[model samples]
Target chain A: MATGLKIKTAAELRTNYLRREMFPTIFCDGCGLGNVLNYTLWAIDEVGLDLDRTVFVSGIGCSSRLPGYINADGLHATHGRALAFASGIRAANPDLTVIVFTGDGDGAGIGGNHLLHTIRRNMDVTVILVNNFTYGMTGGQSAPTTPDGGFSSTTPYGNIEHPLDICELAKALGAPYVARWPVVSPAQPVKSIAEGIRKRGFALIEMLTPCPTAYGRRNGLKEIEQIWRWYREHTVLLDEWEWVEQFGSPEEREALRGKLKIGVFQDTERETFEDRWAALVAREKL
Target chain B: MHTIQIDEGWCKGCALCVIYCPTRALQVAARFSPRGVHPPELVRPERCNGCRLCELLCPDFAITVTEEGRVHA
Candidate 1:
């Protein structure tokens, strides 16, 4: 997958993609959300997407605030309903590219039903779901993706529930494009975002971002470096994970436990809802 | 020659660029910016290989690396 993406200087990216007045960003120091935004812009630039014809839709959350920073048409929708609003936009004007920015709480918890139906329907929209373990905006509450035994404001003792694997869920739902990447690495996420935009049907790119202020402060990762290094140490590439699972020794496999698998989970062609809708309209002459 | 620029007003003093710089060209500044955080300074400009990794990893969009004699504008 040769993205052929020309690396742009920070000044150029700021001039081209960002709404200058919006900065400095509201994100806390050491938060990985900014990295996510940077990678998305790179992907957009690589794809040569026309900002005029693109729509950035987001629900209420820290991650959802990303669209507000981009220099493009954006809809800051209600909590947990970014995909719903994005669906309306795509249906109204199929020509316009729709990209959604949603958080773990916004997309997988409050909007879990929306996430399911959207993937099942195979909507023509790209979703960037930022999973930072906890809900950073609402004062570090335990989100659906919070790791088991992870500490949060809501979970004073520890999160008893297992963390949700969003990429696996999207893959199971048969989304045409699904991938997950930690923000510690730059190139892979940028490439995956661009590929998701190019993919025809439902595309879900899950970003594992670090929330140093909310999540890290509560989870023993008090320092910025600790949290960033945590991500680097915790994530295992999907290919490597599979190899370890198949052939590694018991101790080696045990060491892999609790590590998140990051990579492209699914990429297969399928008939999108828009294509079916168009077919139905042509047939019924509606 | 490679040069790095730091936007003091925008930097949050995260030190990510300092920690991630491959060539050790950057260091946390002793002086504080108006923002009251110690923005990174190009302490060893000669060591910079112009990889632009700091530019890409900087969450604040506060760093820009440009090779001298080349116009990236």
Candidate 2:
């Protein structure tokens, strides 16, 4: 909870944070990517981050375009390499705060290796990875996080592989901050993102956003209401999930299957890459 | 009283606000905006509770809820 911070209204936030020149974003009518951007801005505002000292880094995707809309320094890096660029920025100027906006395809699929090493090294960065289940910009191809039996252009017959749980992967890698939230609910994500920004290590916030035009139309969730409802019904809070798994009946446990767990999965401090590097330099000088 | 302002230029008319409005005070306007989408209209303003859930859920930053005299310039 970011206490004592005055929460700005949408109008106030827009005037203070957004680049007005980027009016009418490129997101689809029913796409939740815009909501992700909104929640992120709220988080940034709550954290009271100095736009001049913060840098937004993103890869080649619809979600990656977010950095351009924010009135701050941004790096529109190559496909799936946003993390690489962000790492460089962090290493060179540790005083600057780096926030990376990446999509499921761009972050988890094409740049899985970079994602792994970044977390392993515990680089100081906040990653807002929007998981829309498919490659939205490239004509709705099956992404690494696309659920099994889900429909997409590349998976017309239905995807055969299991969906990747990005938050779990981050937790396994010992990320200092890890959370998953659906865009349907705004409050939790805003709070979680703020927490991620304040935490001093690798922080991963996986936002499950609706892709009505891309993923939903093919999966019988074409209507905006339907997709939003699907997200609400399919996602369970982390605490509720644990309780169900521990004490629920067989049918109850079975029903919990395939539902995404949302909430802060982990929060722990660790030695960041920048701190360790500083220590190494000091030791070498002695 | 809270007033709901809908910026037609930015609204894509997804109706997320209308659907998620706790008071059901909003409805998709029959008239389309310049963007060719039906922006939400605050039909029953009296029912609005100033919770601003619509403002928060609107994907497009098209909706703003503000107190009567405290409008942001």
Q: What is the TM-score of each candidate against the true structure?
A: 0.98, 0.98
List model 2 lDDT by residue over A1-286, tens digit each: 5764354678887898889889889999889888988998988888889999999999998999999889999999999999999999999999999999999999999988899999999999999999999999999999999998999999999999988889999999999999999999888999999999999999999999999989999999999999999999999999999999999899999999878999999999999998999999999985
lDDT (Cα, tens digit) per residue for candidate 1, span A194-277: 999999999999999999888899889989999999999999998999999999999989999889999999999999999999
lDDT of 1: 0.92
Question: How well does chain A score by TM in each candidate?
Answer: 0.98, 0.98
Local accuracy by lDDT, each model:
0.92, 0.92
- How well does candidate 2 match the true structure in TM-score terms? 0.98
Which residue segments of model 1 deviate by more than 4 Å?
none
lDDT of 1 by residue, B1-73 (tens): 8988888888999999998988898999999999999999989988999888898899989998888877565
Interface RMSD of candidate 2? 0.9
| CA deviation > 4 Å runs, candidate 2 | none
